[model samples]
Target: MSATIKYDDVETGQQIPAADYPVRRVNLVMYAGASGDFNPIHWNERFAKTVGLPDVIAHGMYTMAQGGRFVTDWAGDPGAVVDYSVRFSSMVVVPDDDEGATITVSGVIDQKLEDKRVLVMLTARSGDSRVLSRARAVVQLA
Candidate 1:
């Protein structure tokens, strides 16, 4: 485990550098295998289009997990997280061909709570669409 991040050191408006999470077709396939969400919308383009989707799409939770990973990785500890939430604003369209999709996530310290906790605001974007909206995380710092 990495060293714990201190809450007192963070300032409001402090920006966490954006992270690019590339999601290729292989990633979707791996996520499907790990998450048990083998919905064709996540792997099979034909099935996705049959369901009226533009192409195979990533699972909402999968994208959310990436957002969480970004924060935790930055904070240096997963246990530091107290709360996290996001609204599924748009779909992450994953095509069957290569070049796939990439979701970029960024964060900022928004609010400081009592007892060494901080509220964070997050944004997740894929292509031109925002996949997660009103994303927030409350973390407990050491």
Candidate 2:
């Protein structure tokens, strides 16, 4: 489906409100099972520590998906996003607790492109550490 947000309604440098996504150990475990990326670092705290990580971490792709979700949710259509990419800059450490950790994602309309498309730059952070770098999505707006 096409995006409900029109390209003319958006401007370069306009801010997209930040969204928080809570991640827990169970989420990582479910992700591992779904993705076939059964890496111990994603769910096993002890194994993660042995691998030099402070605690169990969320999968990089999972974190990236959160950023994509932010963009798609804003655009009002998942199919509106024609291109998306990100560089994994840091880990999202998930504690074994009720609150777990939170990944806060925000975006800016970086550029207005031809044919009703716009470049959206994304920022994803877990606590003070930026988890995704160079995150960008090109969306086809209505």
Instruction: Tell me, by TM-score, which candidate is best.
Output: 2
Give the clashing pairs for model 2.
none
TM-scores, one per candidate: 0.93, 0.96
Stretch of 10 with least lDDT, candidate 2 = 1-10
Candidate 2 to truth, TM = 0.96
Residue pairs clashing, model 1: none
lDDT of 2: 0.94
> lDDT per residue, candidate 2, 17-123, as tens digits?
89999999999999999999999998889999998999999999999999999888899988888999999999999999999999999999999999999999999
Candidate 1 per-residue lDDT, tens place, 9-107, comes to: 889899988999988888888988998988778888888899999998999999999899988988898877888999999999987666789999999
| Highest-lDDT candidate | 2
